[model samples]
Target: MPEITYLEGIRLGLQRLMRERPEVVLYGEDVGAFGGAFKVTLGLQEEFGKDRVFDTPISESAILGSAVGMATQGLRPVVELQFVDFGMTAVHHLLNNAATTHYRTGIPVPMTVRAPCGGGFGGGPFHSEELESLFCLMPGLKVVYPAFPSDARGLIYSSVMDPNPVVFLENKYLYRHVKEIVPQSFEPVPLGAARVCRAGRDAVVLTYGAMVHEALRAAEQLASDGGYEVMVVDLRTLKPYDADTVLTAVAATNRVLIAHEGWRTNGFGAELSALVADRAFHLLDAPVRRVAAPDVPVPFAPELENAYRPNADKIATALLELMEY
Candidate 1:
């Protein structure tokens, strides 16, 4: 095992997959020569060649449309949207075409759309955003949001191999900052599974992506300073989120706090809260609380950006209040 940044792990996984499968083709803006805006695809163009690894125009809709056509024609295309915010420009292809092709025609579109998501880099409204909830609403889509370097590598590999149109949401905020030692061998984590990052008996924190790290931090602070045990649940896959694992933790902890980088209203956190209330209401000692971004566009100012994103301190404060209630 070697310590690697989250982006490096993804690069390794893609490289391994491309070597293993000839059908795997990657295309996106600056993916070839520039190695992507975040350098996740650095050195890939030289290895895979221009035919297999190429650049695309600046249209997100065109990129997604091309992926759909390629997938249907027997090519496993991995399309990258430079930023998640640009996904709005191609909502039709994502919502109607990529997501419904399987249901409408009984064909497996083995394609992946990887996009840099979340706020923290002061990327402002146009560059940073989380649109997982938008695609999660579609029945045939698989949504993956991984927090750690190892999980990011594993989940992205799985998404590339999956039969459905999977949206791999990479928290750009974690790309260079989050580090972990990953095994050389690439393993694919199955979709719809949740991992309990930390165990506790007082309260449970249901979260995913970069928020998982924040939740773990809050759990640590709660134990060290507040004497509260916070169970941290990381839902690696958002679309078919692990309900059983979530309920089990909620039952044991009795209190739940759902957290994510997405907005509070109609966000993934709200959906998780609904899932807990629907199936595990009897086990809850207190009402489920959601910690998420404020309902507004991401701000360009550094201070406002910090206020918009949920952090360890905010998560810890919410957990403490929920425990008291």
Candidate 2:
């Protein structure tokens, strides 16, 4: 119906959920009157009031612990960590408690932890970490990272309504950098589904979050520069990732390049590589390649940060290498 930024899409989804569901309550650091660090939650407190949309203390553990308790009860708590990097402090609550509640007992922890992640701005190490792999490691947690505004809006609705714990990763870079016209009324985008953003036959780029955009750009560049048609598959959900779609893409395009903004070692792309190697190795024309940030902290300097993050150039280079292989 209208063009909206990625940040606005998430806000609209949250607003609609609060309006429709009485049990959904949102709280986080300075998320109330002060809005959020990125202002994604701006004006929400005024609309929902303090009880439903309030602020919490400066403890990630306390915030997550309370959410886990509230979720086990009847309430669906949507908590926000100012940055995904801060979520490391409360991993115990997620890994040990929230993730184990249903197995330990019969209770479901329907909680959504909205984490702003990735590096493009000079947010230094603390603010720009991509920790999707960490959340994916948790057995009971579902990880959703949307690259487009429409997907961001729809996934937020589904994540909130889910019975299990969900880690909703909002790439800080995409918050304003990406925008698209989406219908005002939309359906929830099903989790564990991957979208083929671009179609090709020579090579395929498997990525998620901000890297999805980078992969698309790389695909475009390759099509014009080297007459290579590169496919780009966006793994919208990491935990219950769409294996069938991934294998299909790999089968169609005999070469694969897995890209992400996280570290090269043990990142989410590593899992995708393993999946291809394990299930679709016979279908590949080249070894699975990956383009990711080095195993180093996100830098504060703009130049270093730019180099630290994977971009279209990096992905295209890797794609060319895969094509030649």
Model 2 regions lying over 4 Å from their true place: none
Task: Put down candidate 2 lDDT per residue, 33-123, tens digits, no spaces.
Answer: 8888999989999999998999998999999999999998899999999999998998899999999999889899999999999989889
- Local distance difference test, per candidate? 0.90, 0.94
Clashes of 2: 0
**What's model 2's lDDT at 152?**
94
Q: Report residue 107 deviation for candidate 2 (angstroms).
A: 0.8
Report the error of model 2 at residue 132, Å: 0.7
Tens digits of per-residue lDDT for model 1, 1-325:
7999999878988998899999999999989989998999999999989999999889888999999999999999998999988888897997899988989999889999998998898789988888889989988889998888888888888889888899998999899889997778867888889999999999989999889999999999999998987899999999888999998998898999998888889998878888887898898889999999999998989999998999999999999899999
TM-score of each: 0.98, 0.99
Q: Residue 7 CA error for candidate 1 (Å)?
A: 0.3
Off by over 4 Å in 1: none
